[model samples]
Target: MKSGDAARLMGWDTTRLSRILRGTYRVSADDVRTFCGKLGVDDPAGVEEVARVAEEPIGEGWWAAYASRIGQNYLDFIELEAEAQTLRIQHPVIVPGLLQSPGYVREMITRAPTAVSPAHAEMLVSIRLARQAVLSTATKLHALVPESALHAKFESGPAIMRDQIRKLLDASQMTNVELQLLPLTAHPTYGSIGAITVLSYKHPWANVASVDNALGGNHIDDPQQVSFLEKEFAAIAEIALPVDKSREVLDEYLEGLRK
Candidate 1:
């Protein structure tokens, strides 16, 4: 049977089916049994065992510890980031979270629309630092940041902003990272709308997209939405500076800060 037909028979959307197959989505024992029955699996005993296992609760991931401190939406995004094989991120006004420096994180948190305490702010900074671990792994990260982000003034002043730019320069040199600067001279098609991230997993149909807002953000798993964001990322990359040129932009900005 065709995969599309199988998905339809199970009454599952492509995104949900992909998540379930990837073991990221929860499934009930009845649902597991129905899937096995639909597939005509001969081993009733095996199906029962599989259903039993499905009934067990999934264990909490490391990020679960931060549930009370952060919103559920942000936690969900972190999990997605942890599992993504490649991330395409475009930020119009600020550095991407995974690429943000501790000082930048603290400044952004301080200026957040919803105020947070010092302790909570520190936790958020630690979370951003921890998220950077994926850059050291095989996961590929491509960031398209506008040149204006480097020039944006922060209340904390030049020193922190300088540190932020330096962090971008350092991240640009990583083997698994690609950094592009969207120059002021070149206009982006849709990048200025908001910060968006397209995360693609090892599974062919498991791609997702997210748009960051003042609040946490929305995780979009619809195939059509994800595809549009993917294409938008490609278009933005076309208008952005090349990796070497992007690094040069960072260098110039950092030099300006030093002066």
Candidate 2:
């Protein structure tokens, strides 16, 4: 049908329909239902799917405060993260964002390759720390960090790492979080894989994975690719120390930091 016809049927101005078609309009769920009804799209499931995805409030989200200063990739991850039923993350180089202490976050953001103003760095730090709120929610986090990461050098004094380890220890005790440490002696293959995060949703939405690199991060939405990362995380978890043992290892690292 022509744009004019479709617009008339959907009770929308031609310009409005055109903008929606061009993906420039933020069409609401009610608007979608009207469109589907007028277009004879009786499939409730299809209509609901499109409507559900269309109304996600990305522009009006709390993270919108930092949207201009931060990368869209990071924003996308957090949006999905807030709704994820579970998050499986593997970090071999540094502490995962959700578990990092404020000091660690500050140091990491400041040391990042893409330099930002001091105020901007603080904004980033706040965002990361805020992300940790997911841990206290219905969302469960399964994090895999190599033991070496606990001992990784920080430009800041040992105090930074000490506080970080302390934070990790506290997080490990959370009922909704599982923190595992891959021993240095683990299989080379497990230790070699780079950082990855797989967010699993309740329904309708498929799994999504994010791989970290020098260029901030990259999201993998392909079902097959997400499956591969999920399998890889399982294998790594198989080799990582159990939660109780992981806490013991963290304790050892914290003690060493004191020395």
Candidate 3:
């Protein structure tokens, strides 16, 4: 149970175990088995439970098939997202991937300045579409997108954005989904940081947040940092329009798209 003993059992340097404990690093299935054994949880039932959970696929059929295509870093959050009871997202310049229409996704992908091969682009679009399945059931989706995100143009033009807006409105109407928008003139602090999506769960270990950027993404598990991110989201949420008016907000943008 001691730190040094636990490290010795795992054949890890103390700092390495620290990273796993702090969630700055991830663990392999073998690591899970070893840890369970070392921590006095090796009863047959306990061991089986741990093994089953560690081995269980986060995304069953197709999600598992595309495992290699996903970045391990992003996949880490995806695993949590699949089990999370609630998802909170803040997108500054685009629709949240979970709510994007196929046309919008295709537009954003094929037209990105950083060109990808046609085959690869189509694959990415499929992955995005598949991710929407994770929202099955009454899983609550709370979204806060800025007005600027809605106004941004894609190479596919107004129609793509129109479809995106329509899809977003449909999602907002779902019983378990809530949507809001941060006006362009709201306080600039959170917008400067970039997009964030937080996955919350009943268990603390399953809680995490993902931050996206030009380079890649970050998985934030440090309790204090995650708390700060949650607070920042709250601050922006306060500045956002009330949830009831979200449909009006998206519809307003859709009307502009038609003009």
Best by TM-score: 2
lDDT, residue 23, candidate 2:
89
For residues 35-94, could you state the per-residue lDDT of candidate 2 as single tens digits? 888888868887898888788765776777877887888888878888789999998778
Writing each residue's lDDT as its tens digit, candidate 1 over 1-259 gives 7767778878887788888879999889999889888989787777776787688655366787887778889988998898789999998877888899888888887678887887887888888888888888899999998887777787777899889988999999999999999988776554866888999875333689999976689999998988888888899898899999899878988888423
- Candidate 1 residue 213 Cα shift, in angstroms, is 1.5
Candidate 1: C-alpha lDDT: 0.84
Candidate that scores best on lDDT = 2
Model 1 steric clash total? 0
TM, every model = 0.78, 0.81, 0.78
Native-referenced Cα lDDT, model 2: 0.86
User: Considering TM-score, which of the candidate structures 2 and 3 is the better prediction for this target?
Assistant: 2
Question: What CA RMSD would you report for each candidate?
Answer: 6.4, 3.9, 5.1
Off by over 4 Å in 3: 3-61, 204-206, 257-259
Per model, how many backbone clashes are there? 0, 0, 0
Cα shift from native, residue 41, model 3 (Å): 9.9
